[model samples]
Target: MPAIVEETVQPCPECGSEIRGDGRFTLWCAACDWNVDPSEPQPDAGRLERAGRVLARRHGEQLLGEMLDGSGGRPRRDVSAVAATVLALAVHAVTVVLAVGGLWCVVALGGGIGVVAGVVLLALAWLLAPRPGRLPEGRPVLLRADAPELFALVDEVAGAVGTRSVDAIVVDGSINAAVTSYGIRGRRLLVLGMPLWEILTPEERIALLGHELAHYANGDIRNGLVVGSAVRSLTVWHHIVQPLPHATGLEMIVNALYVLPRLLIGGWLILLIRLTSRAGMRAEYLADRLAARTASTPAAAGLMDRLLITEALGVWLRTEANRAALRGPRSTRRATDRAGELWERLTAYAASIPEHEYERQRRAGARRGHQVDTTHPPTHLRRACLLAGQSEPAAVALQAHRSDLIAVELAAARTEVARRLLRGVLDD
Candidate 1:
């Protein structure tokens, strides 16, 4: 695999040109004097230190609290971890109180139509009260528990990482993998993107699944989910209270009283969610480390290499391929069989790009800075962390039988995924 790896070149740190490598593992940037030793990758100690500091500031006491005796210290996963939930709950509690208070005030003000009108307004808010965001779903083929052939690989990976067993496995037409939890105590759903699966080797597959499943074991994604739900609930509350309530000429002025309170509380909730961005970046680092542990450093790094290539080149490749395939003879599930071939072509194309273009893309990705977003650290940072001082890819479950099982057992599911993909193309 490493023989073909020159196709996956690292971006030069100084100039972002494709790093030129000698026949034997020593990579140098022709455009810049950036030298990279793949065999002896350097750890960015600063990144690890920063991650530790964030964990200390936010979760140190909680990590230690679980070891102590009865109820003195904040319990593990105490108020801090779930503080967002507490704040949202507080908002909801206030909502209930205001609704009840309005009801009482209306009854005191009059015994006629005013009471009936107040009851309706309060009832409307009650009906629309915030719930956790519904888990994102699609009409993909679901792998049920009874499917042992499919569960075999999934269970092995989940068990390796010590994460909870997946409640469901879904195969989608997209090219990504994710594990998501919807609400408090929500079941975890695993989504395997078929196109992604088509391109990854079983080992690389482990790296991808391990990384996502690590999100589950680490409570990283759950925290994000809570933050999302809290934000959504706040938005829901704001919209409910901001609009003018239904009332006549003089009564309209009275109903306008709800606006200021909504604005103040909604304003703070927005600020708090933004502050949680730091925590999100920390979780990403931690999850990457966990993925390394499960999939081995080399496998994780390889997956990242392919991912970078895909990110840099996959969109155009997919659009072009889809357009061509629909116009070609082999346009059904048969098209997926050519995914590895497509990926190879794309990788070659990516490798052939001029140094300046590579640098421009790297600069574009780092336009704001090295941070990818609130949820992810920069790819460059993650690439360094994965490659730095790491062992060769872990060799496990690489038997031909396993690979064959993955392909044969999931054939029907993959067919469904391809069907959905083409259906969208046809609809368009």
Candidate 2:
């Protein structure tokens, strides 16, 4: 049985038709779609972040144009990409120089001021070192023994995508899913955001898995250890060298001392972003194509549809939590009861989205340059690329019973995430 939708009627701001929704989600006119999404677009903050977004969007548009022109597969190495790789190598060389200099100082000049300077240099070298990614603490780690069915499904998808199976699966409360490497051994971990997972069809879930796993096969330089650590090092250096605001006396002198180095680091960071933006965007397209090849075109395209609505789903979750928090004081219902209903309500809200709303969101995403993140191309372009790319039969599929078994495995994670989400709102 479906959860009952509690409707309230009000006049729309755009047109005088009645707007209806359950109190927990956005209410809009069915006739005019007034206030379908009331959230204002947030602009990227900081000069560097803004510059990166500009580069990403510009490159994304160019890639979209190439796809439209029927140019397919990985993009060729252009001048910018070649130059960016060179710069990345140069950044790594700096790290190596720092490490060698630190070691030489420690070994050759083994006393007093020399030792102190060597230690300082060594610390900086360690800070700039290429660290492997880590699995976040305080998240649920699902093991094969605990989630064999889920792991089996991921293994099949990995095979289909020509990538190794993830060593672990982590379930969290975010609105996104991702694959990342952890520890010195480079063990892969696939993080499944339950909020996003709950709303997707089983096929779309496979598509999501296929898409994430394909990143391993896509040769995305941005994710490689050398370039990734270089970017991190530059970011850290920029922060360290950035002048403090409203400095006085000694602080003012220190701020002035950093001006030149700050400018140099900032310029290099921006240049790296500009040069690599096209390659990064192309890697995303390649991942999407492999996802389609593994999960069938429709499933991959449907996953894009889910991506477009992520903002709406987030808004709805926040809205629902706020409503529940407010209602807790007035209503006779226990907070536990309200918390337990959150997952069900989320699924209901997702299912309740109409076809017109999807269209409206799609058009809005295109207009707003909506993307999964700065590293990926715009959502609309990714979707279009899926439709235009060669179609493949699904190499992996989720049977209904197997999906149910996986859901059973995820039961504890689901309850924990829901309680955490509700508690977050209530604590606020």
Candidate 3:
């Protein structure tokens, strides 16, 4: 007899049936309470730092590396993936320090001309300093900490993963999860999206949670904040120092002096940013390994697959027909009540797609996995990492039993978020 090759696939988040196998033409899982549709039809959870995670990490590690390294080859000789950020930061620091020394010498010896040179360099350094910057304010919707069920889940996931508990959890509308710290105090925060929650089975949710929390455990979040800043500073250096465009007098001349040099030196900033991005990609692979260890390999890989497909399926179905309706005659308050309606419509929309199309979509997602300067590596790489570490599929519990409770508790919040999303989209 010929050997049977069974391709490993993810299990149902509900009754734990196989989602894929060596077989063909299976879209729905019958043993589950509800079908594994485009996303969960009812309340799964609501929260996240959507944009922060969706966008590539800009320049986080570089910021940390610059201020900390004096003679930096690596941020520290012993640390892995620290070289790119450290070298970038060290170069930045040396430039500044040398400039400062030159300024001092000019002030003491060169007299007036020296002082002029020092002032110019000082202003330049201030604009170019690669300190971490604040995340944009409104990309995420912050919920008060009193949401006990939500907090309990976070705690449970953290305990299971043997990682530190996050201090705050926020929800956004995007399909992503992330963790980060901000400000001098470095308060830990976890971000997960409502849409992301709606898509996963309970264990898959835990897998997602474990993956995000893994960033904290591996110190990726803290390191990013410590060394990295938003990458905007590099590209916008000229704008930061440029004089108002309408100005025609001495102000324009000053702007020319400042902006011209920044334009000339912009190539250096671009190089550092690219290097920082590569470093972030390596860190992502590490986080994925941690997630797979904390979550079962299948669950982790499932989450990756789903995430890849979301851009095409979950997002496409929801937004394709409903933009006008959300912006239509219904009041903001009524939108909250319409949650179930929208979910059903979305499920139906996804269900309407042919199975062949769905498989094609999945394949398409795999192809679009990698991009230059992005924070996450390709989805294919992430799945490989998870599978490589696992000898066999680890059994994760099928039902979390928290989905209904979370949905009930989070109804009002979900409605509010929907309303906010609609308002932003339509300006109504």
TM, every model: 0.64, 0.86, 0.62
Model 3: residues with Cα > 4 Å off, grouped in runs: 1-80, 85-145, 221-223, 230-260, 263-265, 313-327, 330-337, 347-355, 365-373, 388-399, 424-428
lDDT of 2 by residue, 226-246 (tens): 666678878988988988889
* lDDT for each candidate structure: 0.57, 0.79, 0.54
Across 105-140, the per-residue lDDT of candidate 1 in tens digits comes to 587766777787677768765754656534445545
Best by TM-score: 2
Q: Which stretches of candidate 1 lie above 4 Å from their native place?
A: 1-85, 98-128, 132-138, 182-185, 221-228, 235-266, 312-314, 321-372, 389-398, 423-428
TM-score of 2: 0.86
Candidate 3 TM-score, true structure as reference:
0.62
Candidate 1 residue 97 Cα shift, in angstroms, is 3.7
